[model samples]
Target: MTSDSAALPGERADFLQTLDTHRGFLRYTVRDLTDEQAARRTTVSELCLGGLIKHVSGVEARWMRFAVGGAPAMEAAEPGGAVAWEERFRMTEGETLAGLLEAYERVAAETDALVVSLPDLDRVQALPVAPWFEPGATWSVRRVLLHVIAETAQHAGHADIIRESLDGAKTMG
Candidate 1:
């Protein structure tokens, strides 16, 4: 286990800290992006910085609600849910970098608020319909939070590589 996985003062604090770390990674991936650069696909893959931002935000919103046993916010229902890996990375018409960034910020704020209001990370909740996971499996709040962190961190790395290829930018902090 890593230092970040070590026990902390409490579950909520630890979960939030992990989330914040991943969020920082995501933010860094899109740092210094211009509107055109963010939406540009530099690789054979369809991924652009803007599309990645939108994807992560959408995941955050869905998972947060799933973890808390709450109905997902209406905006979370957009994009028809669970696009294929290829489709997810693609930038659609009318999907501007600025628009995606704004949506990300909005969804992130809602997620933060929901997590903050929870009393404990051990609360029982249902898992979202992930392709690899069993249907209707339950998870503790802590597990869901950790999953979100892991998911975001992985995608942030992808975004970093794409961003670098787009303009020769370094991924180092």
Candidate 2:
């Protein structure tokens, strides 16, 4: 377990460990890659190693805001529409793999600290209005953490595939 998670209670520590493990996998997948290589599209999907990091960072940050202040905090945090959403999947001009990784680490640190300090994991907040979500749905802090973990793990898998396609490197055998 990481030092940050070591002092946390059982459930929270578990969340931190699990999240860290997947974050490590995603970071490892981009090991030693150049910025250009990290930004290269290896499949029909717009995803790239750096872009996955960027997207996941944004997602986790947004969800943490939701955890702290519900849906409104999340909506107010990022001021963007469809175009900005699309940009999250690709490295824009002046973006670098190192810079993206650093930003991701910062987000991860903030999330870890928040998770540890939150008064209750059971605190529930109503979800935002979206067709993908059921109307009147609410999620606990635990649920948000779970969603963040799922998102990280899913993107880590995507990064693994992209990394493998880019070179012969694999996150695991």
Candidate 3:
């Protein structure tokens, strides 16, 4: 993102740029695919290209929610239905690769702007209730941003493999 395009300060721009790089790579994996192609599972892993995008989108949105609101507040914002482990890794009914990517981009941009505007990246928040997270582990907002970046980047790599297996497409050379 350019300075003229986004108002992020120097400190925040680095974070945004790193995130944008991986985000673009992930999006590239499913480009020009039909819904069926995107939902295909080429590896033994259940993860599909469309589902990876949706997973990252939901993850970032939740973390951003926690940053803007306290843990308790963020808990209240959760969707009524819980996402099952396997379901989280595949595109569900009525979902398409293109549609998920579009929504992911919107959420990703919002997350970037929100992170840039934070007065202090060191600000901390309690983690939401989850069996996987340590009982008392809390994360700083900056840590949350870093975590999102790591999560997205890992998933991007997974998406690249899935794409390649499906049709020999590569997100990057």
Clash totals for all models, in order?
0, 0, 0
Which structure among the candidates has the greatest lDDT? Answer: 2
lDDT of 1 at 31: 79
Q: Determine the C-alpha RMSD for candidate 2 after optimal superposition of all C-alphas.
A: 2.0
lDDT of 3 by residue, 97-117 (tens): 878888887788788768766
> What is the per-residue lDDT of model 1 for residues 42-157, given as tens digits with 9 covering 90 to 100?
88877788888878887787777777653343225555555555645656767777777777777766766666667777887655566876888777877777888888889888
Q: Write the per-residue lDDT of candidate 2 for residues 44-162, one digit (tens) a residue.
A: 98898889999999999999999999999988746433337778888989989999899889899999889988999999999999999999999999999999999999999999999
Off by over 4 Å in 2: 79-83
How far is 110's C-alpha from truth in model 3 (Å)? 1.3
- The superposed Cα distance between candidate 3 and the true structure at residue 155, in angstroms, equals 0.3
lDDT accuracy of residue 149 in candidate 3: 88
- 96: Cα error in model 2, Å: 0.7
Q: Model 2: which ten-residue window has the lowest total lDDT?
A: 76-85
lDDT of 2 at 106: 87
